[model samples]
Target: MDCPAGVVTDNYDIVEDDELWARIGIDWSERSERSERSGDGLDNELWARIGIDWSERSERSERSERSGDGLDKVDKLDKLDSETVASPTQRSTSLPPELLRATPLYEALSGWCRHWQGSDSEVELFHFSRPVNSIDVFLNLGVFGVMWKAQWKAYEGQCGSHDWQTSRWMKLVTLFVVFNSQAAALTSLLLSAALGFAEVYVGAHVLPLNLWVFCGYMVFLVQLCFWQRIRSCFVAPWMVFLDKMCIHQTNMPLKQQGIDGLGTFVKHSEKLLVLWSRRYFTRLSLGGTASLVYSVKLL
Candidate 1:
Protein backbone atom coordinates (compact mmCIF):
# COMPACT_ATOMS: atom_id res chain seq x y z
CA MET A 1 0.00 0.00 0.00
CA ASP A 2 1.57 3.31 -1.16
CA CYS A 3 -0.30 5.56 1.29
CA PRO A 4 0.83 9.20 1.80
CA ALA A 5 -0.82 12.40 2.97
CA GLY A 6 -1.04 16.18 2.30
CA VAL A 7 1.98 18.51 2.16
CA VAL A 8 4.20 18.59 5.26
CA THR A 9 3.24 20.99 8.03
CA ASP A 10 3.90 21.33 11.76
CA ASN A 11 0.99 18.92 12.36
CA TYR A 12 -0.01 15.78 10.50
CA ASP A 13 -3.46 17.14 9.49
CA ILE A 14 -4.89 13.75 10.36
CA VAL A 15 -8.54 12.94 9.72
CA GLU A 16 -10.72 10.20 11.20
CA ASP A 17 -13.23 10.42 8.36
CA ASP A 18 -14.65 6.89 8.00
CA GLU A 19 -13.02 5.52 11.16
CA LEU A 20 -14.46 8.01 13.65
CA TRP A 21 -17.89 8.09 11.98
CA ALA A 22 -18.16 4.31 11.95
CA ARG A 23 -17.20 4.14 15.61
CA ILE A 24 -19.49 6.94 16.82
CA GLY A 25 -22.36 6.15 14.50
CA ILE A 26 -22.49 2.39 14.16
CA ASP A 27 -20.67 0.68 17.04
CA TRP A 28 -21.80 3.09 19.73
CA SER A 29 -25.37 3.31 18.43
CA GLU A 30 -26.11 0.20 20.46
CA ARG A 31 -25.50 2.18 23.63
CA SER A 32 -28.01 4.76 22.46
CA GLU A 33 -30.59 2.06 21.87
CA ARG A 34 -30.06 0.58 25.32
CA SER A 35 -30.21 3.99 27.03
CA GLU A 36 -33.42 4.78 25.17
CA ARG A 37 -35.03 1.79 26.83
CA SER A 38 -34.08 3.23 30.24
CA GLY A 39 -36.30 6.20 29.36
CA ASP A 40 -34.12 8.62 31.29
CA GLY A 41 -33.92 12.01 29.60
CA LEU A 42 -30.31 12.54 30.68
CA ASP A 43 -29.45 9.11 29.36
CA ASN A 44 -30.91 10.00 25.99
CA GLU A 45 -29.12 13.37 26.01
CA LEU A 46 -25.89 11.70 26.91
CA TRP A 47 -26.18 9.52 23.86
CA ALA A 48 -27.46 12.54 21.90
CA ARG A 49 -24.12 14.23 22.56
CA ILE A 50 -21.78 11.76 20.95
CA GLY A 51 -19.03 14.08 19.81
CA ILE A 52 -16.16 13.20 17.48
CA ASP A 53 -12.90 15.04 17.77
CA TRP A 54 -9.84 14.30 15.62
CA SER A 55 -6.55 15.35 17.13
CA GLU A 56 -3.66 14.43 14.87
CA ARG A 57 -0.09 13.81 15.92
CA SER A 58 2.82 11.75 14.77
CA GLU A 59 2.69 8.47 16.66
CA ARG A 60 6.05 7.07 17.65
CA SER A 61 6.97 4.10 15.48
CA GLU A 62 8.26 2.32 18.59
CA ARG A 63 5.58 -0.36 18.42
CA SER A 64 7.22 -1.82 15.36
CA GLU A 65 10.65 -1.92 13.70
CA ARG A 66 9.75 0.68 11.07
CA SER A 67 12.77 2.89 10.38
CA GLY A 68 10.73 6.08 10.32
CA ASP A 69 7.18 7.39 10.83
CA GLY A 70 7.23 8.70 7.22
CA LEU A 71 4.74 11.55 7.73
CA ASP A 72 4.45 15.12 8.98
CA LYS A 73 4.40 15.63 12.74
CA VAL A 74 6.04 12.20 13.03
CA ASP A 75 9.12 13.60 14.71
CA LYS A 76 7.09 15.68 17.17
CA LEU A 77 4.72 12.81 17.90
CA ASP A 78 7.66 10.52 18.55
CA LYS A 79 8.93 12.90 21.19
CA LEU A 80 5.49 13.02 22.82
CA ASP A 81 5.18 9.27 22.56
CA SER A 82 8.46 8.67 24.35
CA GLU A 83 7.43 11.15 27.03
CA THR A 84 3.93 9.66 27.40
CA VAL A 85 4.65 5.96 27.81
CA ALA A 86 6.59 4.29 30.60
CA SER A 87 10.32 3.85 30.67
CA PRO A 88 12.08 0.65 31.68
CA THR A 89 13.03 2.06 35.12
CA GLN A 90 9.84 3.89 36.22
CA ARG A 91 8.94 0.89 38.39
CA SER A 92 6.26 -1.77 37.92
CA THR A 93 2.49 -1.14 38.17
CA SER A 94 2.15 -4.62 39.59
CA LEU A 95 3.56 -3.25 42.82
CA PRO A 96 0.86 -2.04 45.25
CA PRO A 97 2.43 1.35 45.87
CA GLU A 98 3.18 1.74 42.17
CA LEU A 99 -0.43 0.95 41.26
CA LEU A 100 -1.87 3.65 43.55
CA ARG A 101 0.62 6.50 43.23
CA ALA A 102 1.08 8.64 40.12
CA THR A 103 3.82 7.31 37.90
CA PRO A 104 5.39 8.26 34.58
CA LEU A 105 3.27 5.83 32.53
CA TYR A 106 0.04 7.15 34.06
CA GLU A 107 1.10 10.68 33.34
CA ALA A 108 1.90 9.82 29.72
CA LEU A 109 -1.46 8.20 29.00
CA SER A 110 -3.33 10.94 30.91
CA GLY A 111 -1.68 13.49 28.64
CA TRP A 112 -3.09 11.70 25.61
CA CYS A 113 -6.55 11.79 27.21
CA ARG A 114 -6.28 15.54 27.72
CA HIS A 115 -4.93 16.13 24.25
CA TRP A 116 -7.82 14.26 22.65
CA GLN A 117 -10.54 15.54 25.01
CA GLY A 118 -9.16 19.08 24.65
CA SER A 119 -9.61 19.32 28.39
CA ASP A 120 -7.34 19.01 31.39
CA SER A 121 -9.50 16.37 32.97
CA GLU A 122 -7.66 13.24 34.08
CA VAL A 123 -8.66 9.69 33.22
CA GLU A 124 -7.35 6.45 34.67
CA LEU A 125 -5.45 4.32 32.21
CA PHE A 126 -5.69 0.59 32.90
CA HIS A 127 -2.76 -1.54 34.16
CA PHE A 128 -2.16 -5.26 34.10
CA SER A 129 -1.91 -7.55 37.15
CA ARG A 130 1.28 -9.13 38.44
CA PRO A 131 2.52 -12.42 37.04
CA VAL A 132 0.31 -15.38 37.98
CA ASN A 133 1.50 -18.08 40.35
CA SER A 134 0.96 -21.69 39.32
CA ILE A 135 0.62 -23.37 42.69
CA ASP A 136 -2.45 -21.38 43.80
CA VAL A 137 -4.24 -21.18 40.44
CA PHE A 138 -4.57 -24.95 40.47
CA LEU A 139 -6.41 -24.87 43.78
CA ASN A 140 -9.39 -23.38 42.02
CA LEU A 141 -9.91 -22.67 38.35
CA GLY A 142 -12.56 -20.29 36.97
CA VAL A 143 -14.91 -20.38 33.98
CA PHE A 144 -12.10 -20.54 31.45
CA GLY A 145 -10.93 -23.49 33.52
CA VAL A 146 -8.06 -21.32 34.69
CA MET A 147 -7.65 -19.61 38.06
CA TRP A 148 -10.37 -19.59 40.73
CA LYS A 149 -13.26 -17.13 40.45
CA ALA A 150 -12.07 -15.15 43.44
CA GLN A 151 -8.57 -14.91 42.02
CA TRP A 152 -9.83 -13.86 38.60
CA LYS A 153 -11.97 -11.18 40.25
CA ALA A 154 -8.87 -9.88 41.92
CA TYR A 155 -7.21 -9.57 38.52
CA GLU A 156 -10.16 -7.75 36.86
CA GLY A 157 -11.40 -5.71 39.84
CA GLN A 158 -9.17 -6.04 42.86
CA CYS A 159 -6.16 -4.86 40.91
CA GLY A 160 -7.59 -1.31 40.90
CA SER A 161 -7.76 -0.98 37.10
CA HIS A 162 -10.46 1.76 37.26
CA ASP A 163 -10.32 5.39 38.33
CA TRP A 164 -13.12 5.09 40.87
CA GLN A 165 -11.26 2.22 42.49
CA THR A 166 -7.98 4.06 42.55
CA SER A 167 -6.05 2.77 45.56
CA ARG A 168 -9.11 0.60 46.30
CA TRP A 169 -8.01 -2.84 45.21
CA MET A 170 -4.36 -1.99 45.58
CA LYS A 171 -2.03 -4.96 45.06
CA LEU A 172 -4.60 -7.55 46.03
CA VAL A 173 -4.38 -9.47 42.77
CA THR A 174 -0.59 -9.58 42.72
CA LEU A 175 -0.50 -10.71 46.32
CA PHE A 176 -3.16 -13.31 45.67
CA VAL A 177 -1.45 -14.70 42.61
CA VAL A 178 1.85 -14.75 44.44
CA PHE A 179 0.34 -16.43 47.46
CA ASN A 180 -1.38 -19.11 45.37
CA SER A 181 1.70 -19.77 43.30
CA GLN A 182 3.97 -19.92 46.31
CA ALA A 183 1.60 -21.90 48.50
CA ALA A 184 1.35 -24.58 45.84
CA ALA A 185 5.12 -24.64 45.48
CA LEU A 186 5.49 -25.09 49.23
CA THR A 187 3.19 -28.10 49.24
CA SER A 188 5.07 -29.68 46.39
CA LEU A 189 8.38 -29.10 48.13
CA LEU A 190 7.07 -30.77 51.29
CA LEU A 191 5.92 -33.77 49.29
CA SER A 192 9.32 -33.98 47.69
CA ALA A 193 10.91 -33.76 51.11
CA ALA A 194 8.86 -36.71 52.39
CA LEU A 195 9.69 -38.79 49.33
CA GLY A 196 13.39 -37.95 49.56
CA PHE A 197 13.51 -38.78 53.27
CA ALA A 198 12.02 -42.19 52.69
CA GLU A 199 14.40 -43.07 49.85
CA VAL A 200 17.74 -41.84 51.20
CA TYR A 201 17.57 -42.27 55.00
CA VAL A 202 18.93 -45.74 55.83
CA GLY A 203 16.93 -45.95 59.07
CA ALA A 204 13.79 -44.87 57.21
CA HIS A 205 13.45 -48.29 55.62
CA VAL A 206 10.59 -48.84 58.05
CA LEU A 207 8.64 -46.17 56.21
CA PRO A 208 5.41 -47.56 54.82
CA LEU A 209 5.58 -45.25 51.80
CA ASN A 210 9.15 -46.35 50.87
CA LEU A 211 8.00 -47.39 47.41
CA TRP A 212 6.81 -43.87 46.59
CA VAL A 213 10.25 -42.37 47.31
CA PHE A 214 11.47 -43.32 43.85
CA CYS A 215 9.32 -40.58 42.32
CA GLY A 216 10.92 -37.76 44.34
CA TYR A 217 12.99 -36.41 41.44
CA MET A 218 9.98 -36.53 39.14
CA VAL A 219 7.97 -34.38 41.61
CA PHE A 220 10.65 -31.67 41.38
CA LEU A 221 10.26 -31.67 37.61
CA VAL A 222 6.44 -31.51 38.00
CA GLN A 223 6.73 -28.42 40.18
CA LEU A 224 9.01 -26.80 37.61
CA CYS A 225 6.53 -27.36 34.81
CA PHE A 226 3.66 -26.22 37.02
CA TRP A 227 5.32 -22.86 37.61
CA GLN A 228 5.84 -22.43 33.86
CA ARG A 229 2.13 -23.09 33.22
CA ILE A 230 1.14 -20.49 35.79
CA ARG A 231 3.53 -17.99 34.28
CA SER A 232 1.78 -18.51 30.96
CA CYS A 233 -1.29 -16.75 32.33
CA PHE A 234 0.57 -13.59 33.26
CA VAL A 235 -0.96 -10.32 32.02
CA ALA A 236 1.63 -8.02 30.49
CA PRO A 237 2.18 -4.72 32.29
CA TRP A 238 0.47 -1.76 30.59
CA MET A 239 -2.53 0.50 31.17
CA VAL A 240 -5.66 -0.07 29.09
CA PHE A 241 -9.02 1.71 28.56
CA LEU A 242 -11.42 -0.97 29.61
CA ASP A 243 -14.96 0.49 29.42
CA LYS A 244 -16.00 -1.03 32.74
CA MET A 245 -13.19 0.70 34.58
CA CYS A 246 -12.38 3.86 32.61
CA ILE A 247 -15.88 5.19 31.88
CA HIS A 248 -18.23 6.90 34.31
CA GLN A 249 -21.24 4.70 34.94
CA THR A 250 -23.65 7.15 36.65
CA ASN A 251 -22.47 10.59 35.57
CA MET A 252 -24.14 11.32 32.25
CA PRO A 253 -21.76 14.05 31.15
CA LEU A 254 -18.63 12.16 31.93
CA LYS A 255 -20.07 9.03 30.36
CA GLN A 256 -20.87 10.90 27.19
CA GLN A 257 -17.41 12.39 27.07
CA GLY A 258 -15.87 8.96 27.40
CA ILE A 259 -18.15 7.55 24.74
CA ASP A 260 -17.15 10.35 22.40
CA GLY A 261 -13.46 9.93 23.13
CA LEU A 262 -13.44 6.27 22.20
CA GLY A 263 -11.96 6.99 18.78
CA THR A 264 -9.33 9.23 20.24
CA PHE A 265 -8.35 6.51 22.66
CA VAL A 266 -8.03 3.92 19.91
CA LYS A 267 -6.04 6.24 17.71
CA HIS A 268 -3.53 7.26 20.37
CA SER A 269 -2.89 3.98 22.11
CA GLU A 270 0.70 2.76 21.79
CA LYS A 271 -0.40 -0.65 20.62
CA LEU A 272 -3.53 -2.35 19.31
CA LEU A 273 -3.56 -5.89 20.61
CA VAL A 274 -4.98 -8.32 18.07
CA LEU A 275 -3.87 -11.42 19.95
CA TRP A 276 -7.25 -13.08 19.77
CA SER A 277 -9.90 -14.45 17.46
CA ARG A 278 -12.41 -11.86 18.68
CA ARG A 279 -13.98 -11.78 15.21
CA TYR A 280 -11.74 -8.74 14.84
CA PHE A 281 -12.37 -7.92 11.22
CA THR A 282 -16.03 -8.80 11.63
CA ARG A 283 -16.28 -6.17 14.38
CA LEU A 284 -14.37 -3.78 12.13
CA SER A 285 -16.88 -4.29 9.31
CA LEU A 286 -19.50 -3.37 11.89
CA GLY A 287 -17.53 -0.11 12.47
CA GLY A 288 -15.15 0.34 15.46
CA THR A 289 -12.35 -2.12 14.75
CA ALA A 290 -12.56 -1.14 11.10
CA SER A 291 -11.77 2.43 12.17
CA LEU A 292 -8.69 1.27 14.07
CA VAL A 293 -7.49 -0.88 11.19
CA TYR A 294 -8.23 1.78 8.60
CA SER A 295 -6.75 4.60 10.64
CA VAL A 296 -3.50 2.70 11.00
CA LYS A 297 -3.43 2.09 7.28
CA LEU A 298 -4.46 5.62 6.29
CA LEU A 299 -1.80 7.09 8.46
Candidate 2:
Protein backbone atom coordinates (compact mmCIF):
# COMPACT_ATOMS: atom_id res chain seq x y z
CA MET A 1 0.00 0.00 0.00
CA ASP A 2 1.17 3.55 -0.85
CA CYS A 3 1.65 6.02 2.04
CA PRO A 4 -0.88 8.88 1.93
CA ALA A 5 0.42 12.41 1.25
CA GLY A 6 1.11 14.63 4.31
CA VAL A 7 0.60 11.62 6.63
CA VAL A 8 3.27 11.31 9.33
CA THR A 9 3.60 7.69 10.46
CA ASP A 10 4.88 6.48 13.86
CA ASN A 11 6.56 3.50 12.11
CA TYR A 12 8.25 5.76 9.48
CA ASP A 13 11.66 5.13 11.11
CA ILE A 14 11.16 1.38 10.63
CA VAL A 15 10.02 1.75 6.95
CA GLU A 16 12.07 4.30 4.98
CA ASP A 17 11.00 5.65 1.53
CA ASP A 18 14.31 5.69 -0.44
CA GLU A 19 16.16 2.81 1.25
CA LEU A 20 12.85 0.91 1.50
CA TRP A 21 13.29 -0.51 5.00
CA ALA A 22 17.04 -1.24 5.01
CA ARG A 23 17.84 -1.32 8.77
CA ILE A 24 14.41 -2.56 9.92
CA GLY A 25 12.44 -4.21 7.11
CA ILE A 26 8.77 -5.17 6.80
CA ASP A 27 7.98 -8.53 5.12
CA TRP A 28 5.37 -8.01 2.39
CA SER A 29 4.54 -11.75 2.62
CA GLU A 30 2.85 -11.14 6.02
CA ARG A 31 1.01 -8.00 4.89
CA SER A 32 -2.43 -9.66 5.18
CA GLU A 33 -1.76 -10.71 8.82
CA ARG A 34 -0.39 -7.23 9.70
CA SER A 35 -3.45 -5.50 8.10
CA GLU A 36 -5.83 -7.65 10.16
CA ARG A 37 -3.93 -6.87 13.39
CA SER A 38 -3.90 -3.13 12.66
CA GLY A 39 -7.70 -2.88 12.00
CA ASP A 40 -8.51 -1.27 15.37
CA GLY A 41 -8.47 2.53 15.80
CA LEU A 42 -5.53 4.13 17.67
CA ASP A 43 -7.33 4.65 20.95
CA ASN A 44 -5.88 5.05 24.47
CA GLU A 45 -5.92 1.27 25.11
CA LEU A 46 -3.85 0.67 21.98
CA TRP A 47 -1.35 3.35 23.03
CA ALA A 48 -1.07 1.74 26.52
CA ARG A 49 -0.46 -1.79 25.21
CA ILE A 50 2.33 -0.44 22.97
CA GLY A 51 4.02 1.27 25.99
CA ILE A 52 3.18 4.79 24.74
CA ASP A 53 1.51 7.46 26.91
CA TRP A 54 -0.60 9.95 24.91
CA SER A 55 -0.64 12.44 27.84
CA GLU A 56 3.17 12.67 27.98
CA ARG A 57 3.37 12.81 24.15
CA SER A 58 0.81 15.63 24.07
CA GLU A 59 2.63 17.58 26.82
CA ARG A 60 5.91 17.31 24.87
CA SER A 61 4.18 18.47 21.67
CA GLU A 62 2.66 21.43 23.53
CA ARG A 63 6.04 22.56 24.90
CA SER A 64 7.96 22.20 21.61
CA GLU A 65 5.34 23.37 19.11
CA ARG A 66 4.53 26.92 20.19
CA SER A 67 4.66 28.47 16.70
CA GLY A 68 1.11 27.33 15.84
CA ASP A 69 -1.96 26.57 17.98
CA GLY A 70 -2.47 23.24 16.14
CA LEU A 71 -0.87 21.13 18.85
CA ASP A 72 -2.65 23.17 21.58
CA LYS A 73 -6.00 22.66 19.90
CA VAL A 74 -5.45 18.94 19.50
CA ASP A 75 -4.39 18.63 23.15
CA LYS A 76 -7.50 20.48 24.29
CA LEU A 77 -9.75 18.33 22.10
CA ASP A 78 -8.20 15.16 23.48
CA LYS A 79 -8.68 16.41 27.06
CA LEU A 80 -12.29 17.38 26.45
CA ASP A 81 -13.04 14.05 24.77
CA SER A 82 -11.53 12.13 27.68
CA GLU A 83 -13.42 14.22 30.24
CA THR A 84 -16.70 13.81 28.37
CA VAL A 85 -16.33 10.06 28.34
CA ALA A 86 -15.29 9.78 32.02
CA SER A 87 -17.07 12.70 33.68
CA PRO A 88 -20.66 11.51 34.11
CA THR A 89 -19.72 8.36 35.98
CA GLN A 90 -17.36 10.28 38.28
CA ARG A 91 -19.49 13.42 38.73
CA SER A 92 -21.46 12.39 41.80
CA THR A 93 -18.50 10.56 43.36
CA SER A 94 -16.86 13.82 44.42
CA LEU A 95 -19.65 15.91 45.91
CA PRO A 96 -18.75 18.32 48.71
CA PRO A 97 -19.31 17.02 52.25
CA GLU A 98 -21.81 19.77 53.01
CA LEU A 99 -23.70 19.12 49.77
CA LEU A 100 -23.82 15.37 50.43
CA ARG A 101 -25.34 16.02 53.83
CA ALA A 102 -27.78 18.73 52.74
CA THR A 103 -28.99 17.06 49.54
CA PRO A 104 -31.06 14.42 51.33
CA LEU A 105 -32.60 16.96 53.68
CA TYR A 106 -33.45 19.25 50.78
CA GLU A 107 -35.06 16.39 48.87
CA ALA A 108 -37.10 15.30 51.88
CA LEU A 109 -38.30 18.81 52.69
CA SER A 110 -39.18 19.50 49.09
CA GLY A 111 -41.12 16.25 48.76
CA TRP A 112 -43.12 17.00 51.89
CA CYS A 113 -44.02 20.54 50.74
CA ARG A 114 -44.80 19.56 47.14
CA HIS A 115 -48.61 19.38 47.53
CA TRP A 116 -49.19 22.01 50.23
CA GLN A 117 -52.20 24.30 49.80
CA GLY A 118 -53.39 27.45 51.49
CA SER A 119 -57.04 28.41 52.07
CA ASP A 120 -58.25 31.92 53.00
CA SER A 121 -59.22 30.81 56.54
CA GLU A 122 -56.17 28.56 57.11
CA VAL A 123 -54.36 31.11 59.29
CA GLU A 124 -51.31 29.45 61.06
CA LEU A 125 -53.04 26.16 61.87
CA PHE A 126 -49.80 24.36 61.01
CA HIS A 127 -47.12 24.65 63.70
CA PHE A 128 -45.20 27.42 61.93
CA SER A 129 -43.57 29.79 64.44
CA ARG A 130 -43.81 33.43 63.44
CA PRO A 131 -40.74 35.40 64.44
CA VAL A 132 -41.02 37.49 67.62
CA ASN A 133 -40.98 40.58 65.44
CA SER A 134 -42.46 40.12 61.95
CA ILE A 135 -40.37 43.12 60.93
CA ASP A 136 -37.26 40.93 61.28
CA VAL A 137 -37.60 39.86 57.62
CA PHE A 138 -37.42 43.50 56.45
CA LEU A 139 -34.59 44.36 58.87
CA ASN A 140 -32.75 41.18 57.84
CA LEU A 141 -32.13 42.16 54.17
CA GLY A 142 -31.38 45.88 54.66
CA VAL A 143 -34.75 46.59 53.04
CA PHE A 144 -35.05 49.52 55.42
CA GLY A 145 -31.96 51.05 53.77
CA VAL A 146 -33.70 50.67 50.41
CA MET A 147 -36.80 52.44 51.74
CA TRP A 148 -34.90 55.26 53.44
CA LYS A 149 -32.83 56.02 50.34
CA ALA A 150 -35.89 56.05 48.07
CA GLN A 151 -37.67 58.41 50.47
CA TRP A 152 -34.58 60.62 50.68
CA LYS A 153 -34.23 60.58 46.90
CA ALA A 154 -37.88 61.45 46.56
CA TYR A 155 -37.37 64.37 48.99
CA GLU A 156 -34.23 65.51 47.08
CA GLY A 157 -36.06 65.21 43.73
CA GLN A 158 -33.71 62.47 42.49
CA CYS A 159 -36.41 59.87 41.90
CA GLY A 160 -39.84 61.43 41.62
CA SER A 161 -43.37 59.95 41.65
CA HIS A 162 -43.49 60.55 37.91
CA ASP A 163 -40.43 58.34 37.34
CA TRP A 164 -41.93 55.56 39.45
CA GLN A 165 -45.40 55.74 37.88
CA THR A 166 -44.51 56.57 34.27
CA SER A 167 -44.19 53.78 31.70
CA ARG A 168 -42.36 55.98 29.18
CA TRP A 169 -39.41 53.68 28.81
CA MET A 170 -41.24 50.37 28.33
CA LYS A 171 -38.07 48.70 27.03
CA LEU A 172 -36.94 45.58 28.92
CA VAL A 173 -33.28 46.65 28.86
CA THR A 174 -34.19 50.07 30.27
CA LEU A 175 -36.19 48.53 33.07
CA PHE A 176 -33.58 45.85 33.91
CA VAL A 177 -30.65 48.24 34.20
CA VAL A 178 -31.84 51.74 35.13
CA PHE A 179 -34.71 50.63 37.33
CA ASN A 180 -32.67 47.81 38.88
CA SER A 181 -29.78 50.20 39.61
CA GLN A 182 -32.08 52.64 41.38
CA ALA A 183 -33.61 49.79 43.37
CA ALA A 184 -30.16 48.42 44.29
CA ALA A 185 -28.99 51.80 45.58
CA LEU A 186 -32.07 52.09 47.78
CA THR A 187 -31.61 48.51 49.02
CA SER A 188 -27.98 49.19 49.94
CA LEU A 189 -28.99 52.19 52.01
CA LEU A 190 -31.72 50.18 53.77
CA LEU A 191 -29.22 47.39 54.52
CA SER A 192 -26.77 49.81 56.16
CA ALA A 193 -29.50 51.18 58.43
CA ALA A 194 -30.68 47.66 59.31
CA LEU A 195 -27.12 46.63 60.21
CA GLY A 196 -26.82 49.61 62.53
CA PHE A 197 -30.11 48.70 64.17
CA ALA A 198 -28.98 45.05 64.48
CA GLU A 199 -25.72 46.06 66.18
CA VAL A 200 -27.59 48.24 68.66
CA TYR A 201 -30.25 45.63 69.25
CA VAL A 202 -27.55 43.03 70.01
CA GLY A 203 -25.65 45.14 72.59
CA ALA A 204 -28.63 46.65 74.37
CA HIS A 205 -30.10 44.58 77.21
CA VAL A 206 -33.54 46.04 76.64
CA LEU A 207 -34.63 47.61 73.33
CA PRO A 208 -37.02 50.50 73.86
CA LEU A 209 -40.62 50.26 72.57
CA ASN A 210 -39.99 53.41 70.53
CA LEU A 211 -37.07 51.76 68.69
CA TRP A 212 -39.15 48.65 67.90
CA VAL A 213 -42.03 50.80 66.75
CA PHE A 214 -39.71 52.95 64.64
CA CYS A 215 -38.20 49.90 62.91
CA GLY A 216 -41.62 48.37 62.25
CA TYR A 217 -42.94 51.66 60.86
CA MET A 218 -39.90 52.03 58.60
CA VAL A 219 -40.35 48.45 57.30
CA PHE A 220 -44.07 48.92 56.64
CA LEU A 221 -43.48 52.26 54.95
CA VAL A 222 -40.76 50.77 52.72
CA GLN A 223 -42.99 47.81 51.84
CA LEU A 224 -45.67 50.22 50.62
CA CYS A 225 -43.21 52.39 48.70
CA PHE A 226 -41.77 49.49 46.67
CA TRP A 227 -44.89 47.27 46.54
CA GLN A 228 -45.68 47.24 42.82
CA ARG A 229 -42.07 48.05 41.81
CA ILE A 230 -39.52 45.41 40.86
CA ARG A 231 -36.63 45.03 43.29
CA SER A 232 -35.50 41.56 42.12
CA CYS A 233 -38.45 40.03 43.96
CA PHE A 234 -36.20 37.69 46.02
CA VAL A 235 -34.56 40.64 47.77
CA ALA A 236 -35.48 39.73 51.33
CA PRO A 237 -33.21 37.65 53.57
CA TRP A 238 -34.48 34.04 53.65
CA MET A 239 -36.38 33.03 56.72
CA VAL A 240 -34.58 29.79 57.65
CA PHE A 241 -37.13 27.17 58.75
CA LEU A 242 -35.05 24.05 58.96
CA ASP A 243 -36.47 20.70 60.03
CA LYS A 244 -33.78 20.29 62.70
CA MET A 245 -34.32 23.74 64.18
CA CYS A 246 -38.12 24.14 63.77
CA ILE A 247 -39.35 20.59 63.24
CA HIS A 248 -38.41 17.20 64.60
CA GLN A 249 -35.97 16.08 61.90
CA THR A 250 -35.48 12.56 63.28
CA ASN A 251 -39.16 11.94 63.81
CA MET A 252 -40.64 11.02 60.41
CA PRO A 253 -44.31 11.71 61.33
CA LEU A 254 -43.68 15.15 62.82
CA LYS A 255 -41.13 16.05 60.12
CA GLN A 256 -43.48 15.19 57.26
CA GLN A 257 -46.38 17.15 58.79
CA GLY A 258 -44.24 20.25 59.50
CA ILE A 259 -42.72 20.25 56.02
CA ASP A 260 -46.20 19.99 54.53
CA GLY A 261 -47.22 23.15 56.42
CA LEU A 262 -44.41 25.13 54.72
CA GLY A 263 -46.48 25.37 51.52
CA THR A 264 -49.32 27.05 53.44
CA PHE A 265 -46.81 29.42 55.05
CA VAL A 266 -45.64 30.45 51.60
CA LYS A 267 -49.20 30.55 50.29
CA HIS A 268 -50.61 33.08 52.74
CA SER A 269 -47.43 35.22 52.59
CA GLU A 270 -47.56 38.39 50.51
CA LYS A 271 -43.96 37.99 49.28
CA LEU A 272 -41.84 35.07 48.07
CA LEU A 273 -38.11 35.11 48.85
CA VAL A 274 -35.92 32.40 47.34
CA LEU A 275 -32.29 31.82 48.24
CA TRP A 276 -30.88 31.02 44.82
CA SER A 277 -27.86 29.10 43.57
CA ARG A 278 -26.74 26.92 40.65
CA ARG A 279 -27.70 23.72 42.49
CA TYR A 280 -31.07 25.05 43.62
CA PHE A 281 -32.96 24.13 40.44
CA THR A 282 -31.30 20.72 40.10
CA ARG A 283 -32.98 19.29 43.20
CA LEU A 284 -36.50 18.00 42.57
CA SER A 285 -37.95 19.51 45.75
CA LEU A 286 -36.56 23.03 45.24
CA GLY A 287 -37.73 23.16 41.62
CA GLY A 288 -41.14 21.98 42.83
CA THR A 289 -41.21 24.70 45.51
CA ALA A 290 -40.39 27.39 42.95
CA SER A 291 -43.07 26.00 40.62
CA LEU A 292 -45.59 25.91 43.45
CA VAL A 293 -44.90 29.51 44.45
CA TYR A 294 -45.00 30.64 40.81
CA SER A 295 -48.32 28.83 40.22
CA VAL A 296 -49.75 30.51 43.31
CA LYS A 297 -48.52 33.89 42.06
CA LEU A 298 -50.11 33.25 38.69
CA LEU A 299 -53.42 32.42 40.35
Model 2: CA > 4 A from native: 1-244
Local accuracy of candidate 2 as per-residue lDDT tens digits, 76-142: 7788999778342232122222211111212212322231222122232223333321111111110
All candidates: TM-score: 0.24, 0.23
Candidate 1 TM-score versus the reference: 0.24
RMSD (CA, Å), candidate 1 to true, equals 21.3
Error of 1 at 282 (Å): 6.0
* Candidate 1, 1-299: lDDT as tens digits: 11123211222122223342344453334444543455431233333554312221113223212443233245468789999985422221122222221112222223222322322234333222221221121111101112112211011111111222112122223323433346456756788787667557845556656566645556554443344334335742234334433444456665554444444333333433222222323432223333333334323
lDDT (CA) for every model shown?
A: 0.34, 0.34
